[model samples]
Target: MSLELANYEAQAREAVKMFWGNREAALAKQVASGNQDAGTRGAVTAGKNMDGFLALAQSLVSANGLAMADIHVQRRVLTLPGFFRPTKLWDMLVIYRGQLVAALEFKSQVGPSFGNNFNNRSEEAIGTAHDLWTAYREGAFGEDSARPFLGWVMLVEDCPASRSAVRDTEPHFPVFPEFKGASYSTRYDLLCKKLVQEGLYTSAAFLSSPRTAAGDGAYTHLSELTSLKTFVTDFSAHIAAVAAR
Candidate 1:
């Protein structure tokens, strides 16, 4: 039987539109209250910018035969045990039949400050995956349990700064060839691809959209490997396989 993808392409475009639209709304709300956060923090702190993607994920689980799965999105119920830390909170968690079906992280980055934020995001992604896998290996979820689908989805603002070549200082040694002259978007593409290649996440997606995307819901996938289509297809397949079992 074919995997059910839940019409994710259209949902993803709508999600992209919501992402930008929500950010703008959040920023405006804060400014109206005379409590605007510095830089893009206002949009982020207001939260729910990625709820559209969350809805898509929920739909995929239901369409693929996990309608009864406990999809946790609330902060109080999102904590999972960690190896290095006592607990880690995920953006979403799927549990079914007393087993963890999946855990996913949804993140976004916007500029005037891509350089530092990129490094921070990279470190956080790597560390989070390592921590989760180590905890899983230690039976954090349950004994003799199948590995759950772990996914990461990142949305970045597409603009001149993020798309331009980033120069790095090579004081001691050269950086990796692939990263030497890559733009932020290219770097995120590499990050997502490598996360899957190293078995850190079952699938990772990289998407970019301009501020203007709020009007028409336009977005771009940096590469086929990290595209939203690939992410949703893999996720839907995993959900179907879990249901089969």
Candidate 2:
């Protein structure tokens, strides 16, 4: 059977708009209240910036097949057992007939401090995937549960700082050729691809949009491998397959 992509491109554009709009609104609200946070913490603490993307994911689950699946978005019910830690909270979870269908993480990074934030995000992504997979292998879900689809989606601010090549100092060993002078955007693309390649995630997506994206919801994908299209297509297919069974 053909997979249903659920018209994700248009929905993703709207999601981008919502992402930027939310951040701006959050920042403005804090400033107006005379309680602005340090740096961008005000906007970050507001949360719900990625609700639009979460809605798109929910639509995909229902439109493609599992209309009745329990799509968990509430914070209280999103925890899953982890191997390295007690539990991990996912951004979204899909459960059907007592079986875990999918788990997804949606993340975004804004400018002025991409370097530190990028490193932190990378470590978190890698650790989260490793912990989950290890738990899965140990029957954290169920003894006979099918492998659930794990996905990661990232949104970054597009600007000269994020796109410009970065220099790295290697004292003893040389860095990989591909990463020798990779920009923050390129590094994200590489991270997404490697996550999938190493089976850390079933699929990963990397997106970039300028602050102006709040107006038109314009976004860019670095590569087909890590594009939102590929991410949703693969996810839709997985959901469809599980529904068929």
TM-score for every candidate vs. truth? 0.97, 0.97
Where is model 2 more than 4 Å wrong at Cα? 1-6
**Relative to the true structure, how large is the alpha-carbon lDDT of every model?**
0.93, 0.93
Model 1 lDDT, full chain set? 0.93
So what's the TM-score on candidate 2? 0.97
lDDT of 2: 0.93
- Per residue, candidate 1 scores C-alpha lDDT tens digits across 72-188 of 999999999999999999999999999999999999999878999899999999999999999999999999789999999999999998999999999999999999999999999
Query: CA lDDT of 159 in candidate 1?
Result: 96
Model 1 is weakest, by summed lDDT over 10 consecutive residues, at: 1-10
